[model samples]
Target: MVFKTPLLDKPAPGWKQDLPGPNESPSIEPYPPVLSNPPNHVDNVYLELARATVRTRGVGVWLTFLMFSLAIVALLSLIAYILKEGTMPPPIPGIALLMGFIAALWGGVFIWRMDVDPPRDEPIRFNRFRRKVYVYRFHHHGLRPFSRTAWGVRAEVYDWDNLRAEACSVYGPMGSGGLIETVTLAVVKPGTHQVIDRFHFAHEIQQGEMYWAMAQLFMQQGPQALPAFPRPPRDWNNEDVSFNLARRLAPKVQWPAEIDLESRTAS
Candidate 1:
């Protein structure tokens, strides 16, 4: 038997090729959107605010030192003037000088401590759910999680939770000359008293997206009251691509909600 070729076996016809319209571009599908740069004025203002916040911390430190130094100089001058006058500087005046000395000493201690003290501790609780495979780090690492970068900070996702990877923002510097970025997911239930990873401060991946994702995730499960985290302006928008992706990927079984009431109260 002779072997036949598939394409050559088709019937031949008088062919008229249809072409694209004169002005129409080739029909490639449009690409999905990534995050857009915030509008000019809005972004400028936000950057300005962020820059100001970083600078303000430094300014506060210097201000405290200056005040303490001024207090010491004033106290010494008062003592010298009182001794020179040789009249005990009056009962009322001497008492005022004494008060000034006390204030100076206290102020100096406060200033020194502010610079040397450990970062203010916020109540944090840690838990491991779903074996070593799933661990969650949440709540009150104080300035560690929110105030600093979040690149490599330990984050948690329920095994059953869905992650909408594209919609999240990953921030900060990654190792070996690579930039750091974060992708976050939606959790069915919230956990509590999580110890924050301090080592990840400068390497944050989800500095901006976490607040928005958390808010929407909380809203999706019925209308019961939930504890509020700080609201960022971006949280106002509805239904991001990530939310849709997460809905598709989310685990079929919901995780039980866990509470940490004993560790601390919202300040």
Candidate 2:
């Protein structure tokens, strides 16, 4: 004999639902997309420099205070011990104390300048490799008091493709300026994300898939060949891509090369 299970009726439209327990997890929504400026941020030095400006401010202050305090304490202790233990006469103890004070003061001042109110904030640009990372910076205000202020960092590996950048207004007590930041790309092949090398591209690769992640194609095979037939130039049609941006600049980026983005896009 076969045993049949009884059919259960569906719950009413407005019936109160019973939850499994407090141990159950609640549903979560996906994170929002991050907006960025400067699409090619993977190797831009200027973007990293801006980040350093904010980071260094806090570190510099703390280091300056600590070094200065240590210098004062060490100098005073040295002078007191020398006067108490050494053969120096009681009448000339003030000279020993003065010497110790000077030494301590000098060290404190030197550390203060090096740690707080650093000299410059320069521009930089660089490339980041798969196995290794690279960084570059420009000399800011060449010979001024605050010159050559720059810093850089790199990780073992980053996704070169699918990289994005964004621009925003940087605000400080003084005023505001344009600021840009970059996000490194990542991928999980095995259990975790790992860095790879150039040699991995030894097989068949297509135009779209080959180097979309890379900042610029090296073109090892030389320049690509175009069709033999020449095409006539188009009539005055579309507006220039940088027109709006250029008009606002006091001194625009006037490069000698033709700004033929439209033609490049079409081809």
Candidate 3:
């Protein structure tokens, strides 16, 4: 049975030629066991329940916040010192005031750009037995203070068979790393190539293919056929002290009870 996506009904456009092109992927489904790298960014995998889940990759939100936080604190402290002292130290008083004002403005911009109330991670669940996939997507406009649009989670379910893989190449900042890429799984309309909705799958191109292959293998032959993951299944609650601290600030994963129950159990 094909489960309908809750997000959209229209065909997802913007895939014109020369933009995220190469129409189809060679690593599409019925993928063989030739893939290497077992799985990456996976938070949990249940062999018994035939379920595996992974979060969005490369989101080092904690580090980013830390860097910005320290800078903001320093800038504020400097501004406070200037205000308290009421004396000019380096350049002219006007120049010092101007510099302090600029620093304050930069600090405010940093706060605006920082992801303050982010959902810990965007988790995507694959239920092999049910031949279904669930995405816990957190939608936000920008940081809370600057953004007028409220942020929230948008969960969706899809039939595993209707999904197709699209390898999207991304250029690095200053075009540093040549051929940097990721995999985006497009949900086609039942039997047609028309895309209805999509979600990111993996980070690296080769590893993404391997990860998709692992998903295919698990969905087809169960977890027994899959190789062991390099790292053990992550326990979010008992993660590293630093990550746990970061998690405290981010919103918890609140999957719908019905979807959560259905995804983890064979009905």
Candidate 4:
């Protein structure tokens, strides 16, 4: 005997109303294409320097102050201890005071150097048609304590073809340490192999990939080749193809024998 099981006739609660039916098409608007800055007349790839956060600067200042305070307190305590003990050694009389003085001097010098060599915000631009890289740096000028009363911008240009070699060095605690990796890209002089410029990228691996792609594009493309920014492949970071390409192109860079060294040096 054949028997048919009874089917439930009730509709699932709100299922038909909430979701599109098999024959119905959902009403969805397609996302608009993201618009980027139109390629310049000569197609340039521009990169801006990363800026430090106010919190980061605040922490740095606090750390510096703490270090200075600790140094001062230690020096004062040592002086007081020596005075109370009334101990004098023939080999090094007033040794504690001498050490404290040296420590204070070292700390003062460190703080002075840090203040003089403050971090700069610089942006770099690469021109494919002109085969030049431009770096823009801003300078501040003022009198006495008011050091930042006025500002000026300076531009430095370097030849793309003169880039003899390029290298990316990765350093940081890998594995389980959880420290972020730091990458440095250095451009070297062709024959001398001396580093002319170095670019540092922190945490962001995509920036390093983009730079390596640019280097490869510069090497392989002809002078008249249309200027285009190299797009990173899907597996750019996974396989480290950018790093490999940079290594391969480094040895192939060559400068014309007749090129004037002085003019190159000036740039």
Task: Give the winner by lDDT.
Answer: 3
Candidate 3, 155-230: lDDT as tens digits: 7888887787655565556445555466667787875767777766656556566566666666666667566554
| Model 4 bad stretches (over 4 Å) | 1-56, 86-117, 136-156, 164-180, 191-202, 211-267
Model 3 whole-model lDDT (C-alpha atoms)? 0.53
Ranking by lDDT: 3, 4, 1, 2
Clashing residue pairs, candidate 4?
none
1-267, model 4: which lDDT tens digit per residue? 111321112221111111111112322211112211112222223322231111022233334465566667767766676688775434354565557666654554444323332332333445444455554433443232233334434455676554322222334465754533333333446544356664442223333333333334433452233233343212211333343322222122122333222212323
Model 3 stretches astray by more than 4 angstroms: 1-116, 142-150, 174-179, 243-248
Worst 10 residues of 4 by lDDT: 13-22
**Model 1 — TM-score against the truth?**
0.29
Question: Which 10-residue window of candidate 1 scores lowest in summed lDDT?
Answer: 44-53
Better of 1 and 2 by lDDT: 1
Q: Which segments of model 2 are wrong by more than 4 Å?
A: 1-54, 88-122, 125-267
Q: What is the C-alpha lDDT of each candidate?
A: 0.29, 0.27, 0.53, 0.36
lDDT of 3 at 110: 38
TM-score for each predicted model, relative to the true structure? 0.29, 0.25, 0.58, 0.42
lDDT of 2 by residue, 108-226 (tens): 45434443333222111222222212221211232232333431212222333322111112223544643322221122233322322211110111211212222232111111211
